[model samples]
Target chain A: MNYFDAQTWIGGWPFSFQPAHRAATLARALRGEGIGRALVSPLDAVFAPEPTPANRALLRSCRTLRNLLPVPVINPALANWREQLAVVARDRSVRAIRILPNYHNYALTSSEVEAFVSEIQGRSLRLVISMRLIDERHEYFAMRLTGVPTGQLDRFLERHPDMPVLASGLYRTDLLSLLPRHPNLLADLSFAEWFDIVDQLVRRLGARQLAFASHTPFLITAAALAKLGQVGIGATDLTSIAHRNLERFLKT
Target chain B: MKEDGRGRAEAAELIAEAARFGIEHLVALGDVLVYGRRPAAEQVREINDDTAWLVQTFPGKVSGFCYLNPVLGEREVWREVERCLGWGARGIKLEIANNARDRCMQPVMAAAQAHGLVVLQHAWSMTQIRQRSYHTDPEDAALLAGRHPEVRIVMAHLTGCGIRGILAAKPHPNLFVDTSGAAPEAGILERAVDELGPERILYGSDVPVRDFRVAIARVTGSSLDAETRRRILFENARRLLKLP
Candidate 1:
């Protein structure tokens, strides 16, 4: 199956040593797990004050790797976010704009996010809201951040019903609460887990509503793949979840 | 008799499910949370009986662990352990009944030691949680291992235990960490291998709460070598359970 990882990062993460920090190495790691393409973002942007430099660096690094599509991080809380968006939008390979509401310390319900959503709609770029980067319980003692609240995400999804958004790093319970209400919401399987998880998600939300995500560098890539590969599901549904779902979501 | 047939069918399905993922033997740690923490003696028996049923029904394919509430004190603990032994329980499973360091654990550890049974303690890092008194932290489990050096102990949840938990289990040869609990983080299994050798780490699914395939892949898909993965996934578990 041609797998497309909807959540992956390349760059430095201060908390732990990531062997796949470079774009070439990360791509090779993802490919080893049979992931043909991935929506790549920069880990540097996650902690940076301004995401523009990291965004540009990501676009430059992933330029040669066709399978690694750059998904630039946009911190709308920053006053110069419009320029950041404009710069990353100019890159032809860019398909999605990722926002770290918790890491960037902004509420999804804030006026800044309202305007950010409007700008994303105008640009025809897909929006990926990262609910969390790592499990908060095991986070570094000095720098702990909770996941973006599901209630905030519900309101955000409710406000932008037409804008199809992919919410990454959601737990299984988070997906259960969010997916039913917002049909426009698409989720990745990076964090969602349970017995027969893929089949359960497909049964609950349908295959069209879910996408494959590795949450690479933070999680084992092949572990994420095994969630899909080892499940008892139809080939068509598997293909839809493996790549087709994200492909369709990205196109819109 | 009808219920027995239904249970056998269910057990068959479980074995088949494990077989689908190449899992040969299952260590049935009974639904540890069905009665909530600090289950009554009868509740503990009911849980172990359910496990004993699986072990009796499937013999070689299934190994039973007698779940105990250490707070139940010496008499009840001994009675239940002795009863479970007759039904073929190979290990003792302790959940969040009380902290592992509590005086109540004396009888439970003694029971395990007398019968030559391994002890699987439900342990996680108490760094974030406030309930260290009742909950068994990795540090507490390590203390338990230290107190009873003869007993073989498995500290459950490698991810929840984290780096601190790995370090806590380092000095004690008897304390093994299972690759279960929470989500599969990238480097934890590799880190565990580096800190403690392959034999000290065991593969665990925490099944139903965690996906079996995902848990297995956490070890298989890691940066660890083929031989180390084999030891963690199968050989270590086989040796630990004393499976022929």
Candidate 2:
């Protein structure tokens, strides 16, 4: 079955949109290589504030591509984060709200996001925590983006175990370190690299807890899709990591 | 570079998945540990030990790359190579210890030639990082390839090596770039394919350090043609390592 991408992207004012606006371009590129839908995160969320404007623009651009799903980014650290949360709450079109604690310079331990999590839980909103955005080495020299600390993610999961959060941009070390303790956290298969990520991760966390993320515009869409496509996963496990478990994740 | 007693276990895990995905052959590159602000010979040994263990346990499936320190004396460096060979290591791996063009590399290359082993040097465009003293830019690796024409050299980290690395690698047939490091930059892989062609591009994950699915998938799922993809992903590797 042709799978939908969970961690797609939307961005670009002048050139940033090359990757962001290139979702259809990316979709076409993937189709050339055999990929279908991608649930995207807006570039403005990581690089700009009030991602709604750019996101709205991206949603408009992706009108021709039905496969590109928008998962808007909401910085809980923002002053009007509540307003942003309200916007996502009102707009049923977006399936998930992705958070970048590292890029936003806050810990998951922040009481502010904790309360925001409650509001999200109250509204039954799906939360996808992005542990990182770009490769730490390749990031802008001035930018000091770090992965969400292991202890911080562990505590966040501890405080709210029922929340089925999808943490994209997670490191292999962090995933292995955290998975044994935090069963509630469902990670996107995009950033979790290491050696044999699929088998290692599935054995530890079970394929059901795993979901696919393409991290389009930043990473090769085909590369991300291949993880969900290839690896050692059976057809059943592929169903779960690519869509079934994510479907269950959104349902929760 | 966070460690949680999972690195060793996870290494085996990635190898298994890679094998199933037709990545049957593995090149166990030692986690260079960032040279960690002047890693002593003993620390380097520890890294090599982990790599050697990977190759030894799997024997046929895995090939270990030995880590080196050029700043250290010639004796220590040669000793490490001997130790690695003794432990069944397949080749030598270098990080930002010194530029590949530096005079220190002469001894390292000489030892590699003596041991009848290939040397994989971590290379990237110094244009991005701009730290040339220790880091071996593509230019440095190219210079090394020029210096050691008889000895086989693998320039590690293709995306980090970027356009210039591919260009630097193009002139020398003895030199090859592994499709590892950085996010798969758009067109860089294609550029490498166009310049170096598939035969010169080797597939490496920089595993535990970089994502296998991403790195492997980058080469396998690139914009290049099927024959080129096969060459980069498996054929090239099988030939390079002489694996069956």
Per-candidate DockQ values are 0.67, 0.36
Q: What DockQ class does candidate 2 belong to?
A: acceptable
lDDT of 1 at B113: 96
Q: What is the DockQ (computed on Cα atoms) for candidate 2?
A: 0.36
Superposed on the true chain A, the predicted chain A of model 2 yields a TM-score of: 0.88
Q: What are the RMSD figures for all models against the true structure?
A: 2.5, 5.5
lDDT of 2 by residue, B74-141 (tens): 99899999998888776788777778888888889999888778889888766646589888888889
Clash pairs for candidate 1: none
What tens digits encode model 1's per-residue C-alpha lDDT throughout B1-244? Answer: 0011234456567666888889888888887777788789898888788888888877788888988998988999999999999998899998888999999999999999999999999988877677998998999999999999999999999999988899999999999989998888878888899999889999998876778789889998898999999999989989987889
For candidate 1, what is the DockQ-based docking class?
medium
Candidate 2 local lDDT, A1-252, one digit each (tens): 667566766555231212434666766765665556667766766667566675566666666777766677777887887878787566566667888888778888998898888888888778888876665655544555567787888888898876788888777777777766777777776776655568777877678777777676667777776565555667888788777777777774
- Report residue B23 deviation for candidate 1 (angstroms): 1.0
User: Could you tell me every candidate's TM-score relative to the true structure?
Assistant: 0.96, 0.74
Cα error of candidate 1 at position A198, Å: 0.9
Model 1 Cα RMSD, 1 decimal: 2.5
- Lowest summed lDDT window (length 10), candidate 2 chain A: A12-21
